[model samples]
Target chain A: MKAVGLVAEYNPLHNGHLYHLKMAKQITKADVTVAVMSGNFTQRAEPTILDKWQRTKEALSVGVDLVVELPMQYAVQPAHLFASGALSLLDSLQIDDFVFGAEHPDWDFNSLVQAENKFESTDFSKYNATYATAFNNQLIEHTGISLTEPNDILAFGYTKAKLKSKLSVNLHPVKRVGSAYHDEKIDDTSSISSASAIRKAVKNGSAGFESLVPEQTAVDLKELKDVNDWNDLYPLLRYQLIQAPLNYLAQTYQMSEGLEHRLKQAAQRASDFDAFMRLAKSKRYTYSRIQRVCLYALLQISDEQMQIKNKQLYLRILGFNHLGQEYLHQIKKTVKIPIITKVDQKSRDGQLQLDYRAGKLYEQLSGVEQDMRRRPIIV
Target chain B: MKAVGLVAEYNPLHNGHLYHLKMAKQITKADVTVAVMSGNFTQRAEPTILDKWQRTKEALSVGVDLVVELPMQYAVQPAHLFASGALSLLDSLQIDDFVFGAEHPDWDFNSLVQAENKFESTDFSKYNATYATAFNNQLIEHTGISLTEPNDILAFGYTKAKLKSKLSVNLHPVKRVGSAYHDEKIDDTSSISSASAIRKAVKNGSAGFESLVPEQTAVDLKELKDVNDWNDLYPLLRYQLIQAPLNYLAQTYQMSEGLEHRLKQAAQRASDFDAFMRLAKSKRYTYSRIQRVCLYALLQISDEQMQIKNKQLYLRILGFNHLGQEYLHQIKKTVKIPIITKVDQKSRDGQLQLDYRAGKLYEQLSGVEQDMRRRPIIV
Candidate 1:
């Protein structure tokens, strides 16, 4: 009755993702494989190239037994909260082991976790950089090796989250293949392609995606009428920024250091989305941070709202096979919150409010209509 | 020293608008002509074809002495509030006369006003129609005139507002010409054209606009990158409609009669703006009504917010000629609310809040940049 779980975006459910899912299942020899996947929007505050439901269908078609939505509030955040949120969600399912993608799987987490605990606020105050940069600098100082690679950083976040949850789930790391996280160009590496490169190619209507993704995923990406991006969400984000006051924006999560003023000024004059991003970006704020801030501002995710821990959240099933259904039934009583396959007005509250807003906004952003009444895909 | 005032959209300031302005000045023999023009958004709850400053320049070039913004809270409203807001602002300026375009100039306002005052609310409750329809029916009952013509309705609203204001300003009605209000086709009629026709022609890149609009307007419109319509705004409106809860939507200014429910349902399935508008439109709610409510919802202009009368308003001049400057100088002490030419963080409040939002949203919708720091056009 061993269950293995993984956190992913599966933005297009590409070949690389399928490989990772298969690897997780085979290596762990687990009875059921669960994947906590991002919904419409992703960690960097960008909408998925394809939506959650479509990705779920592709995941089921590939091999994943269960696919549950990583509620949007957690999905479009920094690596830490994203990892924490996904791990927290998976932990609720009573899984025995959690597998993850990592740049360096053999990194000493025992010492790394101890070092993170020993890191002092006083020692980090010398650098005028982001918390991530400061932490990376600290890691570099400690081990003469920086944990700045996307997977390494995320793996560390996952370890920290696992520590926080204090769940019985054992952590397992599998070496990642393919291009680096931020790699913009797709190489001739046959099957393992970065999701970012795949998205970039799909957006500009380029070829070479066929070899990188699963047959279903390749077809879906090629046929996707609206590949959600900042360009599509720009108008809405601009509207939100302009309509709301600076003080109101200031209340949004991560809208500190007088960023509200900069956002307002940028939102006022920037002609389009790219222009706004450039205008808002500064030496102090990374483009990704600005993007997340903009998303937070749009979603009205205030600092107070972010501070309030989303303690009770239901597992929203996207798709499942017979094994996954059996796993759900076996663990039904032990599961924390209710497992929701379909939603109505009555069942929406807490984290679900933000999730619904982000989901509905994705519909608007993509110009795609989703049926709320549809049952989870069973294959 | 007499000044004649007119309230208008002057969306692009075409030949028809110029003709009306000249007639207003000549017919009244007023030394100064004051135009309380709509800012970024218009009476139909649509973004202007051009920004307020651009429209101001066109208005000044076409012989308007002064252009004051018709605060957004009022501009994108029904004829009654549009007329009332304009009249109230003009009353503050102590304008000698107000000129307006009308389908019928000789309509008996005295008896019509009396009939309007005498109309019982309970009598209209039996009809199960809109308040506008009920009022029009009541008017037809008394005067044997349907009072359904666009200009005629606006004229009636102006008269009612004038009565309410109890201002001593003389009301002058100028004859309207060329295409009708909702006319979509560009007719062979020279010079005077319907604003709707001009907009349609401009939107679809149709010919005959050169003959209809002024040389400057035609030139500006030709170079215009984006003349926003429902399509450009569809994403934001759809996002606004879908993201918000039905109960939350019910509190919007025009969300009544279970319209919130209809809006949510329509938003979920409608693929685009036009589809959403069509799906949302009902027998009880006219297309214009639906558009306005969508706007109100997007702007988050609530029923309570609308109830809170925006009392303290300043005359934010868009442009002014020497005569207009002189008039302002002479009446500087008497002018109500501080006349703001340059705005700062401190200046953003009350109706100005809404006006700035509407103006800034115009920039986003149009993909046009406007320098707020630059002084108004002095022609």
Candidate 2:
């Protein structure tokens, strides 16, 4: 059976996302497609607009052949780690091919992947000292191979991970059509935009977003009563800041030398989370980074805990389509670790408890508790 | 006499500029205001929207005490050089005080100036290399005085120039009111914005720009039938790129190393100036820098010529208010060069000819020929 693998969040599958899946199927001519999706949180360290089950069900109903859960550890990482986690899962599943979008898709995929793989060997210690430098160095290294472009960098990561795992999967890249990845403007002509743009459009109540997403995804979003954002979680963040010991607070993600002291001092002075965030942000730490760190602190994710949970372990199932079920059955015999679908009392171990707690927080924060209790939608 | 020095381009006196003049008068309580205005080109290396005569007249009509033109050498420079030229001119006039707008008006001016002066002493070979070092050094030097901030940097430049020149003028910074310098949104609360923001608003044809500029300036701008930007100059830039010898092209302002070779090759292959610029621009050379170099190439300005003209000489008059005449007369004996009030064919020298050519180009490109020919509007 010709099988293709997708790495995504599907955080609430939109129209554009559905179109991508449909296009992937048509272009690849694959019999089955498996998606590795994030659980509660996103890369930006924010709760998803919809519950994971709803998002998973939505993906299955649309087109995905199989739906596998991306662990929380991988879901909230930067591009490289995220790709590593997703590719590892797909490798274990014995997927035949991989597809992704790129601004310049006409470029050669194998050459780009090769270039990216070559770049990993070069020591970029000088440039890696700073965030921008490290990012640009990675770009430069990949550029040696045809994949030196921005979008290709992510694709290159996936290819490199696959190569490392000795997974035999052909790479397919679709030309990214429509507005820029982070462009806030809506171009009615092509109507495709990055998820960041979609989220921003929704938050700002911008017109034309309805046309951007898939029709069903738009309907689902519209049906949802509450739309939560970072600002809404300010009170929770404040509680976390006030309650957490200094040592625990200092160990959160992105928290660096002496920053915890400043954060602690600022938290004491400020009445709200916004004020504390504003006070804590310096030239070195961007507002977004601070926000992520704050979320990590709220989740009580200490440095030791993060170190232990840094790597992907098991693929947790969210939802799947008919083709997805067949692929799952086929992979179950060969795959590593448990492919968790249902969570019972026995499944609530240390890591499972953490996942459950995260789910509870997500449901409470997003006001999607009723949706979570509803039966998972099957294609 | 209590005299205040103004550093400006007076690119046609707008309403918001008039507000600055009125505020300066009230705050400084100066008997006379001396304006050191740009001759033809502006700091962005672009021709002023209007000719110097029309701009001077508008300044005169408003409240300027004296109008002295800043030499073209210093006129089209970066922020530091631009500030130096203006400060030197004000120093030459032996003005007692200088006033400028700052985001945080309450910031300590003297300490900031002291820090800037110290920062300039460290000889750094590479650009932006010493930026952080100089900044931290300045902070250390000024410990217990005041914290270093961004807005203070510009104010500090003025102070340093004055100190270096041994000028008697005291620096006075006014708190900036209204919209932020880089604010993209139109602010209805205060109808004032940075010149950059105003230009963007006008270019975008966004509403509420009418409130940004003076009524007379707005009327003057409206009378100009066409507004041409870089796109319109593309063909001209492209032609210059193709015609100029590679060696000669490299001598243009901001052109460095083998960029001229790159430009020459790009120009041959690209359809237009924009395409050529895009090809030439890399991580090292910014788009704005490339545009300036292209302008310099179009003007046939050589490195030798630029070197010779590095030092500011003659001040070209534009327009002035009632007090401006009295101030001009007061400093007439102390002035180094003969100020040109009207363009005389017999008396106009090489620099004046070049200035006039730049003005003519501005008129042609901006489609403000009729406006250019009009008698100065003495306010």
Candidate 3:
């Protein structure tokens, strides 16, 4: 019952993801494939095109053996934490290999990690630039290869996390086959489009996106009456910023250096999320960073809570096929952490509180139950 | 310039309120009429039919010489607190008389207040009943009367507040005219109807409410698109309750006796405000008490902040006429507290934070600017 694992967002389960899944099985030659996917929110704190369950069903339909949720505390975070959290869960599941996509899959990420280790810790203290800019500055000077693209940075993160955690799983980085991550428009001739491009096509009512996605994803997109984006969630964020006290907001995860005051002022004056972002954006912080902080504030996740929950890891299964069930049976006793098949009162309130809260927030947008006694999908 | 002060919600200024205003002028024989009105929200923690500014315009157009906003801390509170807060502001303005409506104008409310003073302090500790129910039990035993009618309860509160604070203003309890306070429909024969009945008429699209309200109120009601109520604000409440931690909710004003757990649990299960209320309600807490607590949670208001703001009272002018201007000038020298005409940065972030937050929440429904740099209406 050997298994290979993949970490993904599978935002809408496009052809790009299908290709990656196929490559995972081909590259590892494992008996079963297990994927740790983000729950309702992505790493950058954006709501997924489809919910975790819907995405899991899509994954199972496309021959992925098992789908487990990457807990929210890990999902809506920096790339390093997201990569580390997913790898930890996969390692616990005793997966033999981990597959991912990167812009430069052949680059020696291990050397980049070693180069970063040599940089002074105080390099992150530069107040005039963002943390990524500071890190890239050092990287380009040492290795002559700056990590700028999304997957490239994530690849570096995977290498760093693997070395630090001393996990036994092997890492495989395959070349991303289609449209780049940031490409917002779908190419009419291609069957593999980025998730963002598919989402954009759906938003604009453009045709031909059906070819880029699986049957399940196309059906989900057709049923999606409204795209769950910042535009729809801005009112809740604005209300939180305008109402929560400065001291309380200061305690939010990653809220530092009097950012609470700046955010509170912006929420007061800005009429929408874009206007809020424009006002809140600064040289020291990226738009994604501020957006993640806004999500933390909206969910009311505090630094103390995040630090506490980070230590309590779990594998929350979302869906599984017959092979996945057999793999789970094989590894049931050997798994180091809890494997939750259904959400009960104890887990929903205790270890799973963060993900539960995040799911409730997403539920407000999707009008679908996220957790709470919901059983994993079996194909 | 002698002034008679009235306390009102005036959710929408109907003919009943107009008659009350005329009666105040006739009975007090004052040179000017002033009103300390609830802003945006009512005593039951419900959003008004119209915004405070619109209601103020209607008040001034109907010869309410002056209108002052009841601060959020006092506006959305229990009857005693709301009565005391409004009376304190009116007393600061040096009014000659305080007038309000009551179902039993001739009842010995001062005696009732004195009788309440004689009850044992431990009487309120009954765990099986609400504070109001406990107080009523004592009242029924001592005075052979239960203060149940809304205005009668307010009248008792006014008497208690006036006696306890030793205010110099005269107390005038006018007989309430027209529809009963809880009546949901307007009677065709009477021009004077309750504000609730008018709001219901507007909600149901039942016409003929135009004759019940004044010309300005009729115009305001005619232009009303969606009636703002708990139905619209429930999402915000549900989000706050479900996302905020128990300790944070426990700090909410009047959220006592482990009610935070009840509210948080109810928010997790209930999809609407009504369902949330049903789950949250108990024998020990009334609907209004729970509703006010919900508003406090939505605003993220803490008990300590409420206590601090309770002592720092201010007179915020909302609108005025020529006579009202002269009266303000007359009291400008003698007034003990600061008078705010426009919301500056200091006040918006300090003294007016709660009101500003409430206004912002209401603004989401009405699509009108609430408080920043806006001038008071002049008639």
lDDT of model number 2: 0.65
What is the per-residue lDDT of model 2 for residues B213-319, given as tens digits with 9 covering 90 to 100?
Answer: 77656766665544456665554455445444466577776677777878866754565556777788776655556666766666656677677766536666666
**Every model's DockQ:** 0.52, 0.01, 0.86
lDDT string, candidate 3, B250-368, tens digits: 99998887899999999899998889899999877889889999999898889999999999999999999999999999889989999999998989889988888899988878878
Which run of 10 residues does model 2 chain B get worst, by summed lDDT?
Answer: B367-376
Q: What local distance difference test score does each model get?
A: 0.79, 0.65, 0.90
Query: Taking the tens digit of each residue's C-alpha lDDT, what string does model 3 give over A255-283?
Result: 98999999999988888989999999988
Candidate 1 - CAPRI tier?
medium
TM-score of candidate 1 against the unseen true structure:
0.88
Best by DockQ: 3
Q: Which CAPRI level is candidate 3?
A: high
TM-score of chain B of 2: 0.83
lDDT of 2 at B236: 49
State the displacement of the C-alpha of residue A36, model 3, in Å, after optimal TM-score superposition.
0.9
How would you class the docking of model 2?
A: incorrect
The parts of candidate 2 lying over 4 Å away from their true place are A106-129, A137-150, A270-276, A286-288, A370-376, B1-379
Question: Where's the lowest-lDDT run of ten residues in candidate 2 chain A?
Answer: A367-376
Q: Cα miss at B167, model 3 (Å)?
A: 2.0
As for lDDT, the candidate ahead, 1 or 3, is 3
Per-residue lDDT of model 2, residues A25-91, tens digit only: 8888899988888877876678887767767767777778777777766666666677888788777
* Best-first order by TM-score: 3, 1, 2
